[model samples]
Target chain A: MKEMFLIIIFIVASLLGYRVIKEVPSLLHTPLMSGTNAISGVTILGSLVSTAYAVSSGSKFLGFIAVVLATVNLVGGFVVTDRMLKMFKS
Target chain B: MIGTYEIVSIVLSILVLVGIKLMSSPKTAVQGNRIGAMAMLAAVIVVLAYNGIIDVPLLWFAIFVGGVTGYIMAMRVKMIQMPQMVALLNGLGGGASALVALVEIFERYKQMTLFGRLTGQLALAVGAVTFSGSLIAAAKLDRRISQRPIILKNHGLISNAVLLIIILLIITASVANISGIGFIAIITAFLALAYGVLFAIRVGGADMPITISLLNSFSGLAGAICGFTIEDPLLVAVGAIVGASGLILTQIMCGAMNRSLVDILSGSQLNSGINKKET
Candidate 1:
């Protein structure tokens, strides 16, 4: 039942998110993408928390994986975002 | 001895260094984007290799699965759909955090200690709220529902009051090891989700990037709370990284957009005077 609820949550959220983001115009995508990249980077903190909460030694391994994925997303996203914005500057 | 997040971080760092070295030398923006993604993937690859758990055949199979999916999506999807993809994926992060919290709640149920009970409830509440709230925000942004403002006067003030009352009650009851109020905590989550949606809808389309960013931060905080509830040091650290970075990004987004956090939260044009008037 718990797993079912979690699945439901993801499905609903995904559908809704898809709808909302679709409304954004294509011309604005670059700026929106750059901006949301920062938003997506929130995954870093999520990874950290999950990593920190890992109770078992085995869980630590998984936690570390999550943290690394998130950190990459955060830093890489930011640098790329800055570069993208710079294109608009010239 | 090894896991995904650590490897991803190291790979990302190396990519950053390589990127810096190449910076002044000049490159196409498209090339930069491609390299950045490769950096992310490179980290993912290292973690998988370092773990050394999956067999060779499985590793090849996993890569094939992910690659095929990405290729198909890229080939078929319209460029216009990218933002929706962003929202959908970000929603996954938020929803995932909430689910982790749910598991932690069950863990506490088994032990039922003092701080365990309090932290458990808090984690659960935050998770539930993020799960629903992120959904609503994404829905509003995607225009899946009517984009019109669903206005209620004094919403922020009322929400603050109600949430405060609930917290006080919970804090008082927490010492007694109250187990039954978990349902109320769940209800609070429903309210948070609803209010967050309503809040997101009231803001103009121009404001959404920050809204999405802020919600992303909220998800991180939820994960952090989950980490605490589970008593895992690594989870806590990772969660904190998400929470802090999300917060920093939110601040940067707000600065770029010239909106104050307070205005974004309590003073939506439709919400009508939650704060006292200056005059």
Candidate 2:
């Protein structure tokens, strides 16, 4: 079933991510957190869809708000992460 | 047979996973971030282009305004405040997912099957909790709230009681097939929202990074549920990636603090801050 497949992938991905994140140095924790934060902005796609196809004005408004919030999270997260990374590069 | 659109979505999703994996390394992190961002943008564009939705201009305008606001905030915020800002952004992401899920359920309440309804409920509850919990975490990091644990008398009993009530209401609403916007659902939302604040308030500053990471995982899980309700595989894949990564980060953070998840959640270390102060 599709659900079972997703569950399997979830387990595998978690293990892989653990291995990957374990390599990050302590000094870069802040940047790593911020980088992941940007990635979490995947909600923007959902917001956009809801806003564009809303059945009612209330839903439309809610969707609009979602789009804005997700966008802010997306843009801000990336920029902040970049700034933090710059510190280590130098 | 799978169509071109599905093929494209799958490819883009794989790229995103790759980007996240690459990001874990310091040397390729920046490029990995860029790759991830581009994949997200591509996903958005693909969805928008394929779906024949109207009023596209308005959506673009709104995105523009949000981008400007985010750019300004990220630029102005100092490095020391990065953690707080990340918390705020995580909270916003969760809030956005919750709002979209709520809107979807509201518009299609009658058409949803039991599975869809359950997904909706999971997304709603988890999203609301993540939103409020992350905000409280941000406030604590920002020093707007106390960094010490805010434990109430009989805290364990009280919190358990509230959680029990919440689970009961959710089950009742689901079994009874009550509409999402109905009174029971509203009360459940309210309770869940309060639980988020209470949960974060009790976590001390020393354990904040782990708390934030855990909340991030919740938010990502919510997004995955939302994706399932709407049958969006890209969302599911992306959400899973984020959820998995967040969980890993939470574990690493807990290891750093030399504590277990249960120990942190139980508030057993509430007075650890006081002990440090005395030392």
Candidate 3:
């Protein structure tokens, strides 16, 4: 089933990521957290699709809120991660 | 199952994955982040164009407002406050995913098959938990709430009981086609939200980073479930990558702190004052 396939991919991805992240130093933990937050903002795509297809005013309103919240997550996450990384370099 | 647009979207999402992987390294992190963001933008545009929705002024306006808020906060917040900010962003992401699932459920719950309804419920429960839980984590990090493990007498028992109730309600809501089931589902959601707050607040400050990462993974899982509800493979891929990245970060953090995930979750040092405030 599709769900099972996705679950399998999830495990593989987690193991692969763990292999990579384990090499990172403790000094970068904050930046790593912020950076992953930025990537998770990818949910914005789903919000956009939902907002477009929403028919009723209520659904549209929820979709709109979702869009805005997701945008905040995406933009803020990236900018903050950048700032944190900048600190590391300087 | 295979369309040009889907192929393009999948390819772009893979780039996002590659970007995130690159970000684990210090030398290319910023560029990697930019690559990921660009891929998201590209995928969004492709999906929008394919769906034939080119002009939605309200959507653009919402994005503009959100962009300004995010820009200002990211620029103004101090470095020490990054953890709380990350937690807040994670909460927002989770809340957004839940809202999407709720909208879909409201629009089509009556027509959806059991599988569809189950996916919706999964999205709703996980999303609500991540949203509220991440906020509590942020609050603790910001010192708005006590940073120590907040152990109410019989806390574990209460959480377990509530979780059992939620499971029962979710099953009923998913199987029964009555209006009352909707109400039950709503109450279940709020209870799950409260549980999220309780779960996060019980951890000590020293473990806040791991909690944030774990919550990030929860939000990603919520998003993936939301994708299944909407039948979007791109969303699934993006969510999986974020979820995996969060889990990896959490493991690394736990290892660095010399604690296991189980220890952090169980409030291992709850009343003994073993984890003194880290200055």
Candidate 4:
């Protein structure tokens, strides 16, 4: 039953994601990526909470890895983005 | 029934619709609005699947964050700065998804059955790559690094060789079920990160929108693979949504730029100079 739940998520999210991406025109790609980037950032906090809640031994280990990866992705991407935005300033 | 990425889809729809109707074209905005609605519906389905019913806490948290962020960015964040903010958020999401996969990887390793290790390793590689690649691409888009392509002359050869070698090592250890497989596998993880950065550095600014989209897809795919490996339904659904969205974005961005995915990947053609040409 739980597995079915996972499979459903797997199928639906991919499909929705596909539609969302497909419908946009190429000219709007920058705005779309930028909007989604912000959206994806919110996932970090959610993942963090999930990681923090992980109690099983295996889950704990994986949780720690998740924290680290999320940190790098968040920090590195933001820093790069900040840098990129600065280009327009000059 | 909602997630950050889904919220973005929704807001993006609003922005496009409002911005376009007010400024551009209603037809285009209508098209975008439909897509946004689809993304929301998709998020809901996964939310239902993973939790059975939307857990109250998750719902409140997601909605509140969405509301607050939406308000703050809309009211306070300038239109010009909106792009950078979006880039930041997307990078964060990709990062978070990758982490979810990592958690699965770490948890599974100690007690991995033979096949478990194979799935686990694949999850890690993909997750690690997404984490690093997305970051680099974000940097390029954000203009933190040079908007110009940062490729080293022989970058393609070096990156490919390294990736292949990492795969070789993973296959050997997982097949042999060797004692030091874990430690060896960790090295490949770092190597993947390095390759991700190098690959993005060479991609020019003009290509960043597409690059970010592709990386976003990678992140989603990583999460899906992780969910599959750990048998986590919610993660798989959410991950799939992200992966699919990323791919679609990549295609759209590619079309707008009038380039093929192949050219974008090669990193030779995508340069910052082109960004100044036109939208």
State which candidate has the highest DockQ: 3
Stretches of model 4 off by over 4 angstroms after superposition: A1-28, A34-90, B1-78, B270-279
Provide all candidates' interface root-mean-square deviations. 11.7, 2.0, 1.9, 7.7
Clashing pairs in 2: none
What lDDT does model 3 reach? 0.80
How well is each residue in B40-95 modelled by candidate 2, as lDDT tens digits? Answer: 88887887887765348878987898899999999999988988898999998888
lDDT of 3 by residue, A1-90 (tens): 666655554565455544545476787777777877777777777788878888899889989999899889989998998888788788
lDDT of 1 by residue, B1-279 (tens): 234553454345444323322321233334444454555455445434444533544334434543454345434534344444344445545554544444444334546555555665665555445545556655666778555445568766766665675566546545765466545555655655554555555554445656666666566556545545545323343344345444555665555555676666543542332243221
> Which of the two candidates, 1 or 2, achieves a greater DockQ against the reference?
2
Alpha-carbon shift of residue B277 in model 1 (angstroms): 14
Between candidates 3 and 4, which one is better according to TM-score? 3
lDDT of 4 by residue, A56-85 (tens): 756555554444434333333333333333
Which one wins by TM-score: 2 or 4? 2
Model 3 lDDT tens row, B1-279: 557965785687668777776777888888887887788778767767777775878778878888898989899998889899999999999999888888878777888777678888878888899999999999999999988889888999988988888788778778888676557657877988988977887888878889999999888888877877777777776787778778888888877777777778767663343354331
Candidate 1 has what TM-score?
0.57
lDDT, candidates in the order shown: 0.47, 0.77, 0.80, 0.55
Candidates 2 and 4 compared: the better one by lDDT is 2
Candidate structures ordered by TM-score, highest first = 3, 2, 4, 1
